[model samples]
Target: MLPETVLRTDDVAPDIRFDVWREAMAATMSPMHISSPHSSDFWGHTRLLTLDDVLLWPVAMQASRYRRTAELVRKGDPELYHITLVLPGSGRLKVDHSGRRHLSTVNDLYILNSSQPCDVEVEENELAVAIGVEIPRNNFPPTAERAIGRMLGHRISGQDGFGAVLSPFLSHLVSRNSAHRPSDIPRLKRILLDLVTGLAARELDAEPSLCTETRRRNTFLLMRSYIQRNYHDPGLTPRTVAAAHFISPRQLHRLFEAEGITAAAYIRGRRLAEARRRLADPAQYTTSVQTIAQRCGYTSAAHFSRSFSAAYGMAPREYRELEHRQQLDTELRSLAPPATAGRDPIPA
Candidate 1:
């Protein structure tokens, strides 16, 4: 997974929480003029996930206002692009130089350019939550790059089109950060980049710049998605998939060649991975190996056992037993009390 940084105003004294939050924002993001209610206390929290060159920040806090003046832009600017997905608040953003303004509300999204002077005002009386994605201005393809200028200060609806897919994907990513492995970051980053680019292209109606290679890659992605959803179906095969996509079996093979694996092999690998996960799950302990094998597309228990051993260097039964033992050890450790010096020992 991506590396994460979490900041909370609760970590500091209530009186100085706003000051600490302002400093942290200036260091992590760009400098801005901030204003909040005249109350004696402040509360805010932010979680930032860094993936390669992209940054995702999810924030929640008391309603406040912020402004990035031309002076601040001139002093120091990263020249980044930001897409803000507003969750539960009302706000309006104005591009000072362009005289463009966008009124934002719950489930709305807006794009901003770091090189421009902007002012934002959030309604008070309730907490406001938003997730912002930052990327280098040049990260988009030429088609999307041309559209960015016109998109500034314009509200994009998160309820439909590309926004519909992007909104939930980002929310889920932030909510499930702890469940991801390090190796999954690169793949997730690529998917996010593609989705962002596609959204821009859709907005600009730039189908030509999407090009043949990009379309091919998208087709491959769709094929993989189909496999994932249909892996349990015994009728799935290379010919069937190619026919569904209106392509020849030979073309299907060529598509997978780019991934360094054959279609059949990829399918088998995904099935095996799912089977292993099910086998290791504690809730599936009473489930028979033969049933799991059938559920994973293996018609014969012996065949599944042989293939599982070849791939994982152990039989399914042995793997399940080992996972069970590990789970029990973890439970025992959690139940045991901590040892302390000069403290009476608890009776077992």
Candidate 2:
């Protein structure tokens, strides 16, 4: 299994929770100056994943200000590059890097290098959710260094271009971390490295400098992202995807072959996963099974039913009903004070 750690403020006393979080951050990254209106009861949640020399931290925290002054950098610099992707949240996050201040909103990403002073301000009363990755500066390709330095202060769109793929990549790597075995670590590292280097270089129109292998992996990721965005369209097959990317069908299959899967299988797998997601969501509960199937690219309800059963061990309708039952049970349990045995009672 991949090595990971969870840091939470829930169990810590409100008065000292921020202090604990600060000390933890100091040990985890470089020491920073942190201030927040909610400091007395500051709330933060972070899951740290150790990916060899790289560290991935998916965090949700209350609004706060963080600064790494030159004094702090002088005292100790970890020499790492920090990439932060704002997943979803209200208000804005302001990041000052390389002498420029940039405002970031949901689905935006920015970079900060440990060798320089930086400032970050998260708006008050807002809970910001983000996926952050830290990689030793040395880990990046030399060809990317110049571009990365120039791009550090600018905002990158998490919803477009390479950011679209890289954002989801980090999020999934963290969210599905448990599904990865130790044997998967090396391959994950290689992918992570490729995405980071490839994104930076491509952003500044320096794609030609990247090695052929990095370029190949990036093409595969881009094609995967395209498939995901258009999976709702019924005609999104591997052949069509290849044509869209200006590659032959055989070439598309070769890309997946390197990953030990086939292109057609990957497309079907994405569709099935999308169907399962909608099936379990309560908001989609009222939607008809056939409608959901069509929405997920199944033109025929019967075919969708059979596919859903084979993938998830239940028919589409059966799965939706089962989900509803489970959700109702959960709601009923939450409302039943008797069932809150392990939870703390409200303060009098």
Candidate 3:
């Protein structure tokens, strides 16, 4: 069945609302929230929340005096699974199982297994969005034991791993679902659940269980997408690219080999092509050839000019001038339209 609840604090006093949220959540799920100033209210700046389904909890919050304690577990049980992502701001988490207190800032991820308890605190005036996935106690995936009560908190930016793709994808879904149909929610739920399991397996360093190949393919597409987005970095070489994908140098090369190009060569070719196109543009007459070259990854002006001449059989300056004139003539021809027979031919 489709989820049937959208909860917010405006309906009640913030302190009372906090208690209501905790008890209401505990009835259908296993979780707890404790705050330092027990009398303080937290709703004045917080936003309304909608629960798509119990399989996932997506919440967006902006708080000024935001201080709270919370835990999530299986419905009607003390143990199960829960995961958290920090969409914004910075705070600290203390996981008893790990006996460590870690900081979570923008883009960091946090995971918790319900078999045990977790305690976390947020600073005042912090803003964040979080999604929690709840699963039955024994329903935890086979590799779940390894990550029991583990908190994976750090930026998994640029599609490096499951966290990278999952974070942005969930954020987009949660934001767009305001107008989404009920039928579409189930498919989205399955994807998020599968991703959570995959992430847990990864956190435990386990090889993918069944859908390994599919996951690998998705991850590759993700890495390629990141490359496209960062193509202008100039320093985006194999090493940097490998780091982004969280893979070994050999692995990075193999991914490219499968696509038929060496990493460095691909980057260089893209830079050169972008430079050539810019040089052929007419409206950019005032832009210097050296500037274009540097923008396209050439650091030395002399080397760039030499390479440009070799590639096009003329210096960039000469080529730009020729292209500029050609463009002007084309524009003039286009604007003047065709000459009619009644028009007299003029001397050249």
Best by lDDT: 2
Segments in model 2 whose C-alpha atoms lie over 4 Å from true places? 13-15, 246-250, 273-290, 300-348
lDDT of 3 by residue, 88-145 (tens): 5434333332344565556666665444445555554554456545655454454544
As for candidate 2, its clashing pairs are none
Residue 320 deviation, candidate 3, in Å? Answer: 25
The residue-by-residue lDDT of candidate 1 on 135-195, one tens digit each, is 8877777766666667777777876556766787788889899888878888887777676
> TM-score of each candidate?
0.66, 0.80, 0.53
Model 3 spans with C-alpha error above 4 angstroms: 1-4, 25-29, 44-54, 60-79, 89-98, 124-129, 136-140, 144-160, 208-214, 217-221, 224-228, 231-348
lDDT (Cα, 0-100) at 299 in candidate 2: 98
Name the TM-score of candidate 3.
0.53
Clashes of each: 2, 0, 3
- What tens-digit string does per-residue lDDT give for candidate 2 at 1-348? 679999999989888999999887766667899888988888999988988988898889999888999999999999988898898664689889898988999999898888899888888778878888888889876777766888886889988878888888888898898899988988998888888777788788888888888888998998889998999999999989999988999999889898799988888899999999998999988888889889989899999888889988988888888888999999998998764468787899
Q: What's the best-to-worst order under lDDT?
A: 2, 1, 3
- lDDT assessment of candidate 3: 0.59
